[model samples]
Target: MAPALSDILRITSSLLVLMLLMFCMGAINLEAQVGNLAPDEVEALLEVATQLGKRGWNRNMKLCNNTKLPLKPDADNEVVCNCSFPGGTCHVVAIYLKRQDLNGSLPKAIEKLPHLKHLDLWANYLSGNIPPEWANTTLELLSIGVNRLTGKIPGYLGRITTLRSLNIQNNMFSGTVPPELGGLVNLENLTLSANYLTGELPQALTNLNGLKELRLSSNNFTGRIPDFIQRWKQLDTLEIQSGGFTGPIPSSISVLTSLTDLKISNLLGDGSDFPNLESIAGIKYLYLTWNMFTGPIPDWINERDARYGIDLSYNNFTSEAKYRETLNLFKSTWGGNYSKPVEFLIVCSE
Candidate 1:
């Protein structure tokens, strides 16, 4: 019993419609998965807000759409966004919650922010070590200093090659600076001061050829300052006050012709004459205190009128008269106990 032609045609039409409907549904699912700002990331943001004590944002509110909403930010709380997707979806790009006294563990959910580049939580009360999940982002500036964070700085941070400025000073980070950090070829400014870090500077750090400024003051490090610092040809400012290192300034440091500011205080071992700074044509500030330096103070200190300020107090210089003749110890606090980052642009002189 063959079915009638019209019935067969009708059945085929229904089946084709059903198939088309299924295909459309699958396409919609794929779009939701790959196109818009990911749902998981939004959820991650909510988790971050919850952990960070930010109670303003909610899930139903669109992050990018509600840009004009008054969120009553305090203590530099901010959440930057970018919304140029085909369907107007958005992405979190940066989160600056500095000076907020946020007392919580750094959430692992930060890895979900695919477009995030900056995450500055400096001067917070946050505790605990940095989560390994943070390494998954493309961060450029990661400043978390002046916090109560503890534990060893993970070597995985070196994997964040995009980092330009990394300031983890004034924390309780222990252990040695990871040698793997040499992988950050683009890193420019690095501050690891006021930590409980020990051990000599890793020789692998010579690979930071692009380094601009480096601060390692107030640490419990040992051994002589490595001569490998000559590799930092682009270095502008170098600070090493009370770093628990002994011996003279590496003579090779004179090769850093780009240096504008130089600081090395509280050396426990032997010291030599003023470093050869004739190559540094534009030297500005110099802080060389509490060291066992010998010999006469360089007369060139006055020769460079462009020199902004110079501090050579409490050193064992042989020529007491000359040391006093050409010195200005009036720029900063005692022992280089800087509570925050310094501004090098504005030079202070006597």
Candidate 2:
């Protein structure tokens, strides 16, 4: 086989070229499979990690792994980023740092987590305004309630169309209700209770037709209850207590046939005849106390199927007989057993 040196050289040259081509193709495939995280996203998360006291987060720790990270004890617990690996790249899906006693402003860098769906920083000591950068997030549940946060509710939050539940209650946020919130067409549960927020309920809120539970209690909101509230046919639980509303209960509320729990106490107003509630069969809890209502109690209230209870105290109803009749109606309807107590506190001296 030791025939021609030129033939052997040609064959070797062809084999080398083929090997080089194969190596290049393999390198491209590997690059596509194990690509690194986006540089901007990494930078944003690193800023958040640094601002939030680092906790269990470290620059050297793997951001995503096939095995879930173990949750450490309170003092040692990290940011708890739940990540998913798709196409060999790690993507954070949720960040749960609830009750961590975290003390700092929310990092604007949070917008970097494009795949983040749930961000629960509940019961933290985080203060300052919510970062307007959050408007760009595709978050489904944004619960930052029970914090020390202050400043006006950001109007930009309304741009988050994918948001389902937004709980910013128990804070110090103040100012008018942002009309921009009406843009959250997918919102179901909105809790802004126990805050220092003032101003009338925005008319733009009518756009949230899909809302289920709305709590605006313990604020300083003034003005009449909006008539458009009837549009929320899906609403089940509604609480607007301790506001400065100075008008009659809207007759349109009767359209809330799905309503089960309702509280509108300590406002300034007379009651409507509430003609719409006459046929509502699912009502469970009805509270209308500490108001200035000065008419005969509506007879239809006795017709309610309040299996839980009813509270109608501290109002200025004119007749004591009307109160007795109301109590008698409840006793008769519930078979006199009174498994659930009904409150009918009449201020006799007033």
In terms of lDDT, the best-performing candidate is 1
* lDDT for each residue of candidate 2 in 1-350, tens digit (9 for 90 to 100): 68599998999999999999999999986565445555565676788766655466545655533224333323233333333355556566556677788898887878888877767787888889889899999988888888899999999999999999999999999998899999999999999998998888888899999999999888888888788999999999888888667668788888898997887777675543323466556767676666555655666665554344556565655433233323422322211223344454322110
Clashes of 1: 0
- Model 1 TM-score, 2 decimals: 0.78
lDDT of 1 by residue, 191-300 (tens): 99999999988988989999999999999999989999999999999989899998688889889999988888898876667677777876677778777666766777
The number of residue pairs in model 2 that clash at the backbone is: 0
**What pairs collide in candidate 2?**
none
TM-score of each: 0.78, 0.73
Instruction: Kindly report which residue pairs in candidate 1 clash with one another.
Output: none
- Model 2 C-alpha lDDT versus the unseen true structure: 0.72
Instruction: Give the alpha-carbon lDDT of every model.
Output: 0.77, 0.72
Off by over 4 Å in 2: 1-43, 60-85, 270-276, 303-306, 318-350
